[model samples]
Target: MRDIIEIKRIGGNDVFTIGKIDIEIYKCVAEDIVTDEVIITDERIQHIKSRHPDDYEKYCKYMSEIVKNPEYIIEANKPRTALLLKSFEDEGIPFKTILRLVTSSDNITYKNSIITFMKINDKEWNRLIKNKKILYKSE
Candidate 1:
């Protein structure tokens, strides 16, 4: 299965509401980077649930796993990392797997910090970075 990874830049940074696509400030905190700020918001959960009410119960069962082990989400003293932890938890991903990916990636904590939270290794990260497209898809 392919891992889904997407980044969106909210041009209307000031707007905070469920506009075209529902979105909530899922995570907002400080980061140790030149930007010094990171925000992780989820728009698909609600949209997905609304689109599939029959599976609401099933999805709830999966979402419950996120609360099962909070410690599984590691904290590397970075807001971006923490946000990624939450993302992993939402997807029902294991912390050990995330850690393993970290080791596989070269100094993930410093180089390509976001990759530490991603499923891709350092090589894939570099490849994706090189051919990345600037897509500002509107909801």
Candidate 2:
């Protein structure tokens, strides 16, 4: 039996919580962390054609200009994962909950995002967790 059930929708993410465990489900948008630009895919192109046929050409021209630079619109899913992590931080949730998120297979945050927020999230205190002294080891 589940004691607590909570579902939260943020942006395009659906975060589910049963008891104390949280799981996030979301489609990652292609966003370039370097140039802070987003890549426009064919799906969006079709959407533009359907919604505003007259502007489709202009949109394509602009997208073409953006893609000229290789780093302008590279693909990355870290932003979606970062958003979920930030929500946990803002809510004053314990690291245990946040840890569950990264450990879960659903959303994987590379060492980059998690390590970046380490100090802010007090990651040094990971030793306080039960399994840390046994299972936790920094590589």
Candidate 3:
């Protein structure tokens, strides 16, 4: 069931507003080593749109697909975080999405959600490769 947070009367009509709703914008089983279910929420999309307009315009549609099947999965410096990357031949630049695995306060359920996504230059990609932080690479 979808959670409705607010109801406002607009033009004599009741309008529902959702705050921090758990509606799944995209859900898919990741092909990484862990193979966990990845979820992208509307809140996260707004974050991307506001923070990284250029990336949102260029790579928003590819976010779910990248998480579902990333070309490379690198271990992030933060615990329970991973950087999923996909490179397009035409673009040359790699698109990266930061995935964070968070455990609920009850400690029974988990959420693998994307914190943000952006395009990274070749230098950054090469540094990650050189550091050997990669956990998975597609064949």
Q: List the global CA lDDT of all models.
A: 0.28, 0.27, 0.61
- By TM-score, the candidates rank as 3, 2, 1
lDDT of 2 by residue, 87-133 (tens): 13344422211121132333332111111111124463343433232
What does candidate 3 score in Cα RMSD to the true structure? 9.0
lDDT ranking of the models: 3, 1, 2
Q: Pick the candidate with the highest TM-score.
A: 3
Candidate 2 Cα RMSD (Å): 19.7
Residue 107, candidate 1: Cα error in Å is: 36
lDDT of 1 at 22: 13
Instruction: Give each prediction's root-mean-square deviation over alpha carbons.
Output: 15.6, 19.7, 9.0
lDDT (tens digit, per residue) of candidate 1 on 1-139: 0121334445542211111111122112222222212222334334334654544334333232222222223333432343222224455433211211112223433212222222324464344334533112112
Model 3 lDDT, full chain set: 0.61
Lowest-scoring 10 consecutive residues by lDDT in candidate 2?
Answer: 110-119
Local accuracy of candidate 3 as per-residue lDDT tens digits, 13-82: 4433322212222122222322244555566667878887877766665665676667877877776667
Task: List candidate 2 stretches off by more than 4 Å.
Answer: 1-37, 64-139
Q: What is the lDDT of residue 29 in candidate 2?
A: 25
Q: Per-residue error at 55 for model 3, in Å?
A: 1.0
